[model samples]
Target: MNFLDGILFALFAEADKSAPLMVPDSVQKANFAETVRKLANLDVDQLLQNLLSESVWILIKVLIALAIYFVGRWIVRRIIHLLDAVCERRRVDVSLRSFLRNTVRVVFTLLLVLIVVSTLGVNVTSLIAVFSAATLAIGMALSGTAQNFAGGVMILLMKPYRIGDYISAQGQSGTVREIKLFSTVITTVDNQTIYIPNNSIATAIIDNYSTADVRRVDWTVGISYGDDVDTARRTILGMLAADPRVLREPAEPVVWVSALADSSVNLTVRVWTKNTDFWDVFFEYNERFYKELPAAGINFPFPQMDVHVKNE
Candidate 1:
């Protein structure tokens, strides 16, 4: 008999206490082997059916997730495009408009990702928690950058300065070239480009030269003490009057004796001109004053020293 037959026969003998057991070991072994085989077959069949059903369900979920992603992305793009059209119609500032577009896209994309994760049976709450922690860590790591971003947003909203406006801040003067999320780009008079942090600019004093429609140009002209102050003032006034760009109604060109220097009389000439023509008017007036003053018998005083040395 096989090992299974021997084991089964011994078990039967132990159960019967009144008389010795006489069952054949071969039959017991065969019966036990057949039962085990039947159970194994049944389990294998059940397991295969369950696996196939689960695989189909998982595939359907995956397809649904993919569909949601594509449709959601298309919707987001359409909404952003519509917003752009509205902003353009409203004549929104370009800097703020671009910032809004990017912000909306990022927020919507994140929402879409969460929806997709949920469709795929992922725990969204846990995902959100993880993202929150990551964001906090990143914010801590880049505190200054975050401050600059906030400052930029404030600047765009408040409009302290706009593109093409000449500004002086932090000891630097230039025309605003671009306003970004974290920095402002400026182009200097000499064609040099500079990038200033938004935080610094927003917090510090800003002098915007182009905020007004017109600007005042002031020049101090010095003439020899012997020269006629009236003649000098008249000459300067005539030059200003000749410039068509100079504004007259609000306040005409002002010329007055500002001071009496050691060897000359200083005349302060103030004129109002359109912002666009300010620089041109300033240079033109300066050149004319220097050239015409001498022709009008107005002498510019120069420092002179005369020493009378005796036997000392």
Candidate 2:
């Protein structure tokens, strides 16, 4: 007992001994002894016997509660597995799988917690009400996060680009490395990494270069005004044709007299090739055109100013 309780009990014992009823020393000692001695008396023993009778009921309650918790946990796991299987069966978007899995796991854990609390005789309806109120407050506090989450959900549901697709969006152009609910990861051509938030990505104009099987390579060639325009056109077309990477199925390369200036005529050349061969073919054709056109007696135009000699 605490010191205060000990002093109070001793004072009470002394007062009892001085009472006119005149209780004996032996009886007073029994009444004032430690709680352990008091509990060992016959009356206390009978009270304990009554409590032991109800102990079995408490054990049963504990076992039932434990069983509910364990079984509920098992059910939660099964639900998660079922969700994963459903996604696989429907060929659902992979970017959303991780998000859905985490959400489902948290929800199931919460449900299990609620069920266990209910089994232990907690007032679950009130608990739910309290949790809902708290959740509403939290939602208000993190409204920006809610908007991002909504955008993320939309991005996952409607995939604009998949992993490894070369894309340009939100002022960044790169090959998509990974797509998550919150952000889209991109690795640029120069190997620089960039992350675009889902909210911005969803609203921006996305240029997906990897979508098309073929990409057109565009280049402009300037020719001297005096050179044979017909010869230049034929030579450029021939170079495009000789390259196996160029797509002949789309017809021969288109060469047009796009622009005419005082010094030169600009010819625009467009060639179509498989996306994989785009860079290789474009570089090869540029080098070939620059080297071969001159050898073929076709003049490449350069800036020139004619200086008239003044005769005095």
Please report how far candidate 1 places residue 272 from its true position, in Å: 0.5
TM-score of each: 0.70, 0.63
Distance from true location, Cα of 114 in model 1, Å: 5.0
> Model 2, range 73-141, lDDT digits (tens) per residue?
898889889988999999876666656876788878888888778877789999999999998999899
Q: How many clashes show up in model 2?
A: 0
In order, candidate lDDTs are 0.86, 0.80
Model 1 TM-score (2 dp): 0.70
Clashing pairs in 1: none
lDDT for each residue of candidate 1 in 4-96, tens digit (9 for 90 to 100): 454456445434356446657986687577666655655566557766887898899999999999999999999999999999999998777
Q: Which structure among the candidates has the greatest lDDT?
A: 1
Task: Supply the global lDDT for candidate 1.
Answer: 0.86
Worst 10 residues of 1 by lDDT: 11-20
Q: Which stretches of candidate 1 lie over 4 Å from their true place?
A: 1-78, 93-95, 112-124, 305-312
